[model samples]
Target chain A: MAADKDNGDQEMSGLLKSNFGRRDFLRTSAAAGAVALAAPARIGFAQGGPTINMQTWSAAVDTVQSHVNAFTEATGIPVNYGNAPWAQYRESMVTKFVGGAPLDMMWVSDAWLPEWAEAGWISPVDEFDFLMAYNAEAEDFCTNSMTYNGRQYGLTYYTDFMAFLYDESKIKEAGFDAPPATWEEVVEQSLVMKEKGISDYPMMLAMAQESWLIEFMSALVFSHGGRFVDDDGMAVMQEKDKGAVEALQWVVDAVNTHGIVSPACVETGELSGLKAFASGNHAFAMVAKYRLRMLNDPEQSQIAGNVKQAMMPKGPNGDHNTVGWMRFHGMASQAAQDKARAESTAKLIEWFGGKANGAYTFQKFLFLDIGAGFGVKPLFDDPEIRAAYDAYGNVDMIQAQQALAMKKDVVTPWFGEWNETNGSAWQSAILGNTDAATAVMKSAEFWDELKQDY
Target chain B: MRRLFGYEERSAAIFLAPVLAVLMGVAVFPILYSFYLSFFRIKLTRPNRTPFVGLDNYLDLFTNDLFWVSVARTVTFSVVSVAAILAISLLVSLLLNQNFRGRRVLSTILLVPWAIPYVANALMWKWIYDSGYGALNGILYQLDFIDKYMVWLGDQDKTIFLIANAFVWKEVPLATILLLVSLKAIPSDLYQAARVDGAGVWQRFIHVTLPAMKPGFMLVLIYETMMAIRHFDLFFILTEGGPGNASHVLSWHIYVETFRNLSFGSGAAMSYVLALVTFALSYTFIRSLGRKV
Candidate 1:
């Protein structure tokens, strides 16, 4: 009995001694762990429902889940989700629509709006008064997005506009005080950067099919004051402006004359270009704002702090134009619930655009450019958030400049049929089968013929 | 005792009913439904917009340049890939039939490429063919074999060839394995007898092994052609039929027209056309091989 009592006492003393010795250390670790765990808790409280479906980019799914978790915490909602890559998402959406399956809501690219609306697949937002309530206070959100054809079809959750990301250290080493302010300067700086061996290449633009060319062409047309369509929506290729043509010539020269970019640019996709820029192989890359998150991740990036984002350079018109790509979430046509439920869902959309939620979603999922109609205006007002945008130095300023100068794509009428045609023309041009002028001209003619039938 | 027409009709019915029911439910229904859909003006996104258009969908497909072009490409691709695979497999099988050192190790290694996933294999080859900093171009440049990089999959004219190369590399291994199995099954006594008669390696192969492996060759031809016809992943990952639709096959056209464009009627109609072409080609191939074996 005495021996047993003595052993218990000794065990108690050991526990006490260890606790005393590591109190401070254990306290700090416990606090850090709580902060980490708090993220999921916050998510649970924000989302009130048991589940909601979302169709977001595969790359951005994790970032979205964090927000969804926070939403659940705030509102006691649960989220059951499915995700698809951007390319496959279109196919899946079509399949789901055709099969008449159960779907609550899905991410809709702006390019999909006209088709979805014309097809009558998406529900009208005007039926729910929640949008109007939010629109009154946040006019910027409604005007810039959501409002298609005078009636709002959906709400914008996030937007990403294209911009140039530069390695400031490399550029400074090349004797440039600031980023190239114009297209001419971009070319000159690329050559200069290449000559000094600061970087083996000056600029990297994604020239692959579908994704990059769509953005690149939009930037060209916008900066050069070329319009793809008239007010009447007739297909017009106003190459007479010469500025858009100059942009095309710049791309051609970047390949053949300047040789600043690697021939691999023609083969690289957006994600690959993001990888290359984050690896410090290229000094500058034409990319969207979303790349910032990947660049910031220490585990995935080697040049984390060395890179910065900036607006794409301007043309002779002095306007640095970019292509603004926005994604909106709309209720499925099959979701014919009560008007009150839709109003509640509409309120959820508003909540997504609300200040706190917007800040959370943008800082988390939207690491690059802020989507309009959300809390971008208020989120940018916070100095800490602004600083985060420029952690690599002046990136925020450059992105802001570009966003201010950005323009919407022409939203081609025949985008459905001839989407692959542009890639074909670009590839043909790159392979020396035909020159850029011929390719662009031929695309213009094709675009016209395509619309003629429509 | 209740047999009719020299058989137990009730017993036969009892055995066949379940199988017939399953077939009707699984196979015949879907085929008939697809055929039914092909006759409508259906849009995937607008399911309610479907209207019976009789033979218009098929007629429209016939007039569609992209459709006809994709069909031609699919046929050409199927023929070249099947023929190349068969030829390479036959040669490899012949090589493997010989008694050689470390033959097992070599045969295993040859099958490794086939074991990998098709998409993964295609991606691996894509990286190798990458014009900028791809391993293949990098090595070629180092060796001074080429002055500059070539976008192997970027140019439309070269894309089909690149895709074909990837397919052949992936497929030849399986064909070789199958052929090798058949070759081994050939009676060694025949070879011994030929040898006794002063028959050389070439003569023994031509007279004995070749005759024994006719069934295997035909099987490879049928399987490879069908596989080549149904392929979507290679073209999807490689070029997506670019440089002006040079590599775009009928399968991809069916996909784009159905989903991307959301014209399900047209997509279904195109798919039916693809199915018919494949069936006809497969039939012709089997017919030409004859049935003596």
Candidate 2:
């Protein structure tokens, strides 16, 4: 036995000498050691049951994990929840999908759904019988937004719409009795606030290079009675009837000509505007309804009780229109390829969006927790849900109505590209790099080129 | 075990296998695959519909005004950033090479910015450059530098420079360390001889130190130029190539085309174009610098 141990020790030493040779090897070994040390601890799960994996942004992870845990507890199926930041979520999803990783479900933005659905990355929700019941409870716009090529591939889990969130005290300080109802009133009231020093910038517009800016612009275009695309699904921002150029010009004029908005508006993102307004520094901000949660949070907001929500201001054309940005829970096509996994994923979807179980109630409560509008119709009419927003004075109801009323624009597969191109032009115009009409016309040509590729 | 090849050859092959595998998997395969994909009309959103469209994608990119604009911006960014990095790093290296008290401690601490992750460094600088409630504006305001806070990122002309400043700050430490190592390697005897020969301080530096540090200086310049040309994270996090494409670099545009637009063909073609430009420029620089060295 001692001889055998000696032989083993000799072999180990020989192996080390062969593999790790001197200074260069030591450096490489040190790097490998550091990498190993930096690696996260491996999490172990029980061995027997089918496991479901869900990917989403980190912001939704906790809420998603809670739901996952409840589903696992009731069904005895293990679940793996993966999350990345909003910036990395799309890349992660695409990598996982292409790599053939077993992803059961994922939360995708509405803008990304068409692309994923068209690519066959996600399965159609119509294959499951539970969707009929689910669709019955969901709002038409929400359900319609998830449908592509006559097939539903996802269910709207959280709904948001653009609304005018304002600091009531600031507006009152500017001698306004009510929130602005027209573009003219908005400019006038913003000037008043600026003049009175109630806010350095009276309005916070999301002009950052992000989807939020595009969404805001879409609302602006819609409010001006403009369609983002023509009936042939071609970009028509250059068309005179659409008012797209006019919508962009108004935003530019607000920043450069009127100077009601500070140059800082060019840096404001969706959340940044909300946070700025919540700091009691702005009279008004055009932001999503979900920001109400942060603005209402006593710990997170200074203007919690002093803020009010109103419908988006009308445009020069007197059009009271806006757009809805929806997020949905989609099942992976790979998961649907297998019978058992498909059934399990469908059940998970039902538990998240279907009205049969208390899952829908829990989902509504979760949306309410974040001050987001739910896609289901009954939740809006729920007295308890309605009463929860008493502090904000019926903003929840207002958002719900707006979500229903807003036009669902740019739902096609090319929406993402179009939005990005349009956003760049608008940003240029806002920054005075180019005129609004010139920017829109140039962007329109780019959009037309992008359309050909699709 | 019995070796199939000679002992030295076998050992060398065994030792290199892992690294070669890693290189092939991570670098070589992706490059070849990207080149292949560039010839096809591929969209990530239409995976099954990819069709062969050789040269069209490249033609489209060359013709596109936005692509050319981004290339120009990238060149401007690289030139300015590389110059700034070289000057600052050379100055720091010179200062740190002196035999002063706490020289070692200062040298160690100087790597803090380099040690921080690029994304984290970018986020910190974003806060510093923030138009509202940023340290830069706050400091300026407190000093009565301006009546109101200036939005540093809002202005088109300043956005690229501001991001370039952040990039230089994060990059200077590595360049400094590289140049400092070269500086330290210069023989004290050379400086002693220079002084004895009646050379002034500036003359001694020019005669004795500069020539000795040429190799390291060239290395840092090449490395930093490459880094600046292919810079992605700093632009992505700080400006996102924006305030209206004012700071849009080639890499950022490539990323937007590839990932955001899901036009993999166009993105890959642009990336190859960028790669060719970088390769040509780097080769030219190295050849010229090699002659000098």
Candidate 3:
């Protein structure tokens, strides 16, 4: 007993005298931190949750969780649900995929269809007849957006197009009875609004270098009757009279010459533009159609009751065309290798992307909650859905504009690489660092280079 | 007689094995792996098609116009940021070193900006520099300094400086502490001797104080230069190398090349180049540190 006590006392004295306690605590804390950091970066597989793992950008989190809970209760399959912020979602997902983190299903943007499919990060869902069957019900545009290399990847999460939104109060106050119908008219009305001391910068265009830049530019180019790439996937945007140059030139003149759009528009992002427009500081803005709901929400919008949508202004040689974009649920290629996990993932995807309880429950919930455009034709005719649309937007105008919305011509395996260059080129033109023609040409050259390399 | 442990050297090696293994795992492995990856064409999009492309990535970057532009921007940004950091920290440290009341509280409070993560700091600055509803514009407008809420970050001419400002603010605290340490280490007898030599405050500062700060200056110079050269979060959060690539520095270029373009080989090559430059800089500073003050 004395010997044991002596050993204990000696050990205590050594620890205290050498400051081993502090060192041990720091060492243990560091180990704990390393383990903690490694844990999340590993696959989303967890101890208590269901075997099926689903990841998404944080959007409508509560609604998604509720649906997940219902699915778990009904199918007796638990799910591990996780999400990152929308801005960082793509990088997070890419890192997860490259690190070989186990992902069963996750949200994918239409723009990434070719890249992800090429990387073998995601697998085609055509093998599942039940999921494929709903493609017939989906709009051809949405369905086409989801397909790459003749393989269908997944089902639609939501779909929307860029729309021309105006503050009704601002336009009316600026002595405009109708919104501008052409790019020239847009400049004229904006100048008038500016001259009259109404809106300082009467036009809001988000020319910031981000994911949304390509869409905004595409909409402009398409409406001006320009194609970024030809049917053979060759560069056409660099052509002098092609819509790209004209669209870009107009934006440059708007910022530097007309004084209608803020030079700061080059720094403005889509969300920032939306908030600016809602704050009633601009007479006109170009944003995704779904933003109309938020622009008209009394709690969030300063110009709630007076926000209205108009057809995208036609460029000099172009029609009122716009860019359409969509997001879909993707099945990880790894998850498809195991038949059991495949079935569980498919059921979960179906539950969210397709019919839930045989009633398109998830789609209805998503559309109603967020006002995201639905791909199903049946939902368009639903009275309640139509009424919700009528409250915030013109149903006729929405259909007419959406009909002209085109998928971005730049979608390819090398789209991500090309997009960075293209976005910078456009911003360079807007900032007068380069002329419109050079910007368009630079974008075209890079696009072609990437195409050849890929 | 047989002993439980091996030879002294062998026992030391055995004891060091775990730490060496960890260093190899975390640090040495990644560094070497990236260097190896720099030799291949590791496009993530074309994962199955990685062909060893022998120094081509480096050649392409060195030849590219955009790469040169990014290098120039990085140099300018680093120089301006480091200069600002060194000057401001020197001033702040001198003030904080004094035996004033609330000195401790003030010194502790000085770390608030340094304590915040660079990302959080970037976000705060983003709001402050916002074109609309920005506190910068609001305060300037209220002060009658400007007739309008002028573009700040969006102004291509001023973007690098604005980003540099935020970076310098976050970096100054650590540099100040380092300077304060140097000040504390200076012998009081030196200052007394200078006074006895009929030196005034300015002369004493130049003769006694400045020379003693050589080590601190060396530390601050090396650290801040490396940090400023690689600083990414502010540019990413604020401009994303825009208002037309005005703030497009080498670090952003590497990020765009790697993550956005998914060209890991080229990204690795750029990183290795940066690492080499950093090492050369540190070596130069260390050599200068050994010089007479």
Candidate 4:
């Protein structure tokens, strides 16, 4: 009976296979249909199309989408567009990389390239045409931003620098003509503001999360002539570099001794940082250029015209430093599942980055539409763009100050991961959970742990 | 007729096959694969290069102090949290079993914390523990219960306590659910018989309820212990295992090794070690109960 049953089952299986069309034709057809949907993408790219994904909430969203339409009409390459929430963008990209999902191109923060490249998560561009097309003014692009493993990883998408944002009216109310130019002067003027009770919170630092902390403190450390991390992957802080420790101590003193920053500042993250500054609760914040937009927005900000941007205070080392940071949008090398798609995507990237598309994208879409107002090299000198920015004379002066002074922090080969690892520890120190020395030591420990794995 | 020990041959095979296959597929295969991976240098970072390294990762991890420290931390957190969950859940289940008004409502309320997403729960608790504008400090200050703001989540030394508190709050409800189900399963006749024999509430609980709920208790213990080991989201959200690694647990350490450090070999090795440790703890629990499925 068992032998007969086994023979019967085998015969039935063979019969079923024979009845199925053309050796799994249905499955093949389904896959082919999906590919057919993707065929138009090739057609678009062949005509010099560029597809882009941007953060949904960013000011640049509408601008980028419209510019994509224009670029497609001009170049005949269809632009594919997608959007991501700012909060989830970083984690979403990581998921795509891990899952090998179909994301041919995307945007990433400048700091992410090193770790991404090290993990072989992105493709290196060596083509001269692509480079020339992507960033024609390559030298003007922040040198430290794009260089990874001594190779150009991507083109600079936009530029932004942090400046000291103060209430110009508040300063004037405190009988000052302008913002303070030195830490001592800030303390003195803040004390004056405190006595007059004009500003409840004289100064505020976004000491909550490490991302802002690193940006704010790097500028401080660099002004004092300290290297954050050395080439061998050792944190220079471990060596008790005079500049780093001094800068850290100054921050600690600013919190504990001066009592200028709110105690709650320790628990505040980036959004909260922006909120505190915009609410007129704080007199000064080391903030990026885009904050002015929020301050000017009537729906979101309470203190509009009162806000003014100023150069960051000069350190005792007789030097002032600033850090300009921004996100970079590009195509992912790992995005291509096969050769044809990869070729088409690469060509699209080249086209989008080239002069005909690049200038339009930056001018019409990114800067104007997004209200990002970030200046790219080619469009930096555009009269209208300059006029829009120069309308606020104080902000214009601060932008000029930053351009002359700030350096993009070295994107260390492993710096992206370092940010993830040590960024929080830096916050802890400022929050009074740990002292400056222990904080640096703990940061060093994290660095060392990462180094071993590297 | 061939004297087959009277077992229903077809029924027996059908019952065993599913469980046997599941045990092999989900449990056995992964364990074996992890063990194999532990011996080699597999990089989660560089997925393309999975070259084998004989015991180098293991040796490196063994020598690494951070790994050992995290292991110690994980063990401590697991033991403390598991024991607290068991004790609290048992007590709560006993209270709920009493005939009382609003018992069901209270039980439903207990389920709310478990229903909450881990990230949301973390944020809620983070606010409660916030130093400056948090509910705890705010109320304390308003009521003049304390003089100066105390940073509950801010202190490194106190972070483990905060994390444990969150874990206990979340897991006790689940443990209570299991224990309550087990309690309900015990026959009322057993308790009535114990009462007739002049048994008190404590005595009945000791003799009848405890013995009857052994399987359920063991299951809850095993599940909670595994969860305590594997769960990194809450810690990642609340502490980022920081204030200088004071709160860094094994899972978080493994995450840093794999994702942040991008050392696939070391990350794989650490993760395998973590899995092994979790397995050993679970196996010990199962063996001590004198049970297998």
Better of 1 and 2 by TM-score: 2
Give lDDT tens digits, candidate 2, residues B149-207: 89888788898889889999999999998998899899899999999999999999898
Q: Write the per-residue lDDT of candidate 2 for residues A1-454, one digit (tens) a residue.
A: 9999999999989877887578867898899998787552222124424677877788655677787888788776677888889887887787777778879888878777777887789988797876666787777778877877778877767776777778888887778789988888889998877777777778888788976777788788887777767756677777775758878888888988878777877777777677777788788888877677678778999988877778778877737677786778889998888887777777777767665345475556576556667777777667777777665557455744465455355666777777767777888889888898899898788777767856
* Clashing pairs for predicted structure model 4, backbone only: A49-A77, A59-A370, A60-A370, A63-A365, B43-B264, B44-B264
lDDT of 3 by residue, A1-454 (tens): 9999999999999877887787788998999999999776453334333378899999989999999999888887778899999878877888898899979999999988888998899999999999999987887778888888889999988889999988887778878899999999999999998899998999999989988888999989988888899877899998866748998889999999999999999899999988998888898999999888888889999999888989999987889999998899889998899887888899888999898988778778888987878776677777888899998898878888887888887899989888888888988888888899999898998987888888
Residue A426, candidate 3: C-alpha displacement in angstroms: 0.8
Better of 1 and 2 by DockQ: 2
Candidate 2, pairs of clashing residues: none
What is the lDDT for A106 in model 4?
60
Instruction: Quote fnat for model 4.
Output: 0.17
| Top model number, DockQ | 3
What is the two-chain DockQ of model 3? Answer: 0.53
Q: Pick the candidate with the highest lDDT.
A: 3
Q: What's the C-alpha lDDT at position B188 in model 1?
A: 84
Badly placed stretches (over 4 Å) of model 3 are A1-54, A65-85, A95-104, A127-133, A334-349, B1-15, B99-105
DockQ of predicted model 1: 0.28
TM-scores of all predicted structures: 0.82, 0.87, 0.88, 0.78
Per-residue lDDT for A166-234 in model 4, tens only?
888788889998788877777788888888987655887765544566777676776655656665445
Residue B268 alpha-carbon offset, candidate 4, angstroms: 2.8
| Candidate rank order under DockQ | 3, 2, 1, 4
